[model samples]
Target: MHLDPAIDGFARYLATERGFSVNTVRAYCADLCGLATFAEERAVGTVDGLTLELLRDWLWEGTQAGLARATIARRSASARGFTAWLTRDGVLPSDPAVRLRSPKPGRTLPRVINRTQMQDLLDKLEVAASTGDPGAVRNLAIIELLYASALRVSELVGLDVGDVDLSRLTVRVTGKGDNERVVPFGVPAQTAIVRYLQAARPALAAADPGATRSGTKPSGSALFLGSHRQRLGVRAVYRLVAALLESMPGTGPAGPHALRHTAATHLLDGGADLRAVQEMLGHASLGTTQIYTHVSAERLQQSYRLAHPRA
Candidate 1:
């Protein structure tokens, strides 16, 4: 009947039964703990003491404290999910958060690089790759594959040496929820990847001579290695992409995911099937893939405004 035990059980359920990613499970746990703190303040010591009113009051308090709408909505969702789990697990006779509602967060358009700007960016990388510097070659390969395949940064870093099929010009990536898919890259990406694998990778692996004697060569089965010869972290990828996008015009995030948005938007702009992009991106829902269409339309309107002179 303890709240902590129930929370622990729910966390396990999310991780084991629901197959949620580690970060997602952590967020759910943290949100639920916030609710527990509120409940304890009201002298409610167990899961059974939760009520719909209490849940609403918690959200109201957040609003009074000037919490962002997104945070309040996420907390509401956490409560609903946790209470529903309790009812199903017989911790409660009925769900208390069945009617919980929260304010919707505003949706902003994703930043997308137009074809011309994208080309100009790659032109710079292409020039750098001509130097045959291992870092330059690897950077060219990473950005090319990222733009071509619309891969998440995690999937790009998570790739193994054998995951890439050079002959087929495809890379096998594991997306969210461990959904695996083989996505084809264009000839440019294929060329960069081939060069990196053949020359740059060996050069990087050998860069750390101490790894041979220390046996610390493989910190992970990562396709992309940091200067330390370890798996490249997502923060490093964010830093890399952010620096490249420092001068680019955009509103939303400037991380590696912006490359993903650009790839999907470009595919839609080039008349690719919506469903095909969905499959390639490994999105579980078709609606999630439709954002690119909106981006494409916004681009079209801008192009028309700039080029049309009838007004």
Candidate 2:
């Protein structure tokens, strides 16, 4: 089969058979598409024309063009998976990527907000929410739940009204791979959520008349709605977080994931178990969770350097 058609088939397989998330499938397809373009430039457009040399040359070209190690590593993985699938499906006689290798990406510690900064930020939000502005109230609830639950923005925005258990202070989060887990939150988050639901949500929902005209409830079951009274999107949440963190001291991304990192690190600093943090993070590998341990150790060293008299 042609490489383009083969990539399309692989994408379908990833979505239907492998149960990969939409973003994962999209990323895989994007990498394959880039590979396909490169192959076409070399007049090797069919799957049969794909060889190990071509794959290596492609990665080499990416490195020469100054692509980050992480990007090159991801591309290598994408190619390996594609060729393996092709081999299994009889599209290729053998996997060309079996011998492929890429440089390992260096692991950087995630950025975390200090306890004092996080508290100050939350206090400011609380003051804004007290004015009874629906947007301010909803924003406060969003940040609280994000910090409390350590949820990915995707999971946070995907939440439905029925997913939250206010009485138990737990939220039913559908994480990556459609895995469902009930995560507990603190009283502050619970209070913020309750306030949003009671006052803010209704006000926002009333702004959308289309749903009512169509004989459906405004905002439907979405736990968080946009100003348009539709389910909130990931990009909106990213913008919200970025704006809030703009003036704050931080060296990494200012997205909602920063809150997740802060929450996990804070939990570890407070003596939470590693395995429990892993579970809360929905990380399949313990090694991923162990990175936070390193973060905590770094913080300890910093404190020791500043406070100890033996410096």
Candidate 3:
């Protein structure tokens, strides 16, 4: 089979059969597309023409081009998956990428905000929110919920009004691969959310008078809204978190995930159980959640260096 048709079939299989997320499928397709272009440049156009040597050379070229190790590792996985699928579908006699390998991505500690800095940030936001600006109020609520629940931006924006139980102080989040989990938040987050719902949301919703007149609520039951009263998007949440973190002291990426990392590290620092934190984070693996333990240990070491008297 031609590589193009085989790649398309593999992508469809990932989406419809494997139930991969849209972003995951897109990444897989992108890697394979790159491989296809590489193969075509080398005059290899069919699935059968994809050799183990060719796969290694493609990854080598990516390394030479200075692509991140993570990107190369992902591309290797994509090629392996594609070749395995081709073999299974009788398009190839054997998988050429069976022995394909890429360098393991280095692990770096996620950026965490110190408790004092976090407190000061929240205080400033609360003060701004007191002015009753709809955007300000909503921003406070968004940040509060993000810190309290450690939610991914996609999960945060995907929330609906019915997904939140203000009385129970919990939210139903649909995470990666459409997995659903109810995460709990504290009293402060509850207060912020209640304020947003009662004050900010209604005002933001009313900003689009045409939606009300047309009898079509553009915002629908979305828990958050843009200024135009439409459902909030991932990019908007990113910009809000990025702007807030830009002035703060941090070395890692200034994005919503930083807030998530801070929340997890803070929870671990406060003696939260590892498995429980994993559940709250909606992380499928306890190993993934263990990174925050490392963060907490590093913080403890920093404090000890600063305060201890012994040489």
Candidate 4:
């Protein structure tokens, strides 16, 4: 089989048998495709022809090309997974990547927005909405929901009209791995959503008014709509959040995920149970959630250093 065909088959196997997420499958494909390209340039034709020396050469080439350590490490992991799979399936006699190694990547903590900055952003959003612009209302709702529910940008944009229950102040979000969770928001988010539904959605729908809607018909069933009245995409949500942060003072180089980190940290700061915060953040491991405790502890230390006189 051609390399591309074999790679396609392996991707299908990952999706169906291993149940990897789409993002993971794409990363695996990109990594293996790079290797295939390198092999093709050297006239290598089959998986069995792969060797540890060839893998090392590939890593050296990547380093020569100035790829970051994180990228090189991920590529090594991808190669190892593919070679192990091929060996297990009898496509390769041995796993050449078992001996391949890459440099370790530095651990970077997630960026989090402070509570005052978050509140300032929300206050600015509210002021923008009072200008009678419907888009302002929609933006306000998006920001509020993001910070309130600690949603991934994908989860936020994937929301449909029925996913929100304003009366109960809960939103049903489809998280990573397609797992669905109902997360509650505070009154601010609920209020923002209500205003958007009442004032903004109709204006947004009216601008397009495509075959997708009418006086009724639930306004096309998307909770967030683009200017063209289609489902809002992840990129749009990202740009909106980035623009909001750019206009704020004392904000760091944070994105929508920063809002999520801020929400999770604040929940822990407010005495929410660690496991409950984990569930709300859709983290598969409590260890991931426990990082917020470290953030909280650092904040407490800063407070003590500023308040105490005796050192």
TM-score of each: 0.93, 0.96, 0.95, 0.88
Give the per-residue lDDT digits (tens) of candidate 1, residues 175-217.
7776789999999998998899888887777666565435555
Which has the better lDDT: candidate 1, or candidate 2?
2
TM-score of 2: 0.96
lDDT of each: 0.88, 0.93, 0.92, 0.86
Which candidate, 1 or 4, has the higher lDDT? 1
lDDT of 4 by residue, 124-217 (tens): 8899998878888999999999999999998998899899999899999988767889999989999999999998988887774565544534
Which structure among the candidates has the greatest TM-score? 2
Candidate 3 per-residue C-alpha lDDT over 210-240 given as tens digits, one digit per residue, 9 for 90 to 100: 6543454576799999877788989999999
| lDDT, residue 238, model 3 | 94
Which window of 10 residues has the lowest lDDT sum in candidate 1? 211-220
Give model 3's clash tally. 0
User: Using lDDT as the measure, what is the rank order of every candidate, best first?
Assistant: 2, 3, 1, 4
Q: In model 1, what are the clashing residue pairs, if there are any?
A: none
lDDT of 2 by residue, 132-241 (tens): 99999999999999999999999999999999999999999988888888899999999999999999999988884754445434558999987777888899999988
> Would you list the rank order by TM-score, best first?
2, 3, 1, 4
Candidate 3 residue spans exceeding 4 A from truth: 209-217
The candidate with the higher TM-score, 2 or 4, is 2
Q: Score candidate 4 by lDDT.
A: 0.86
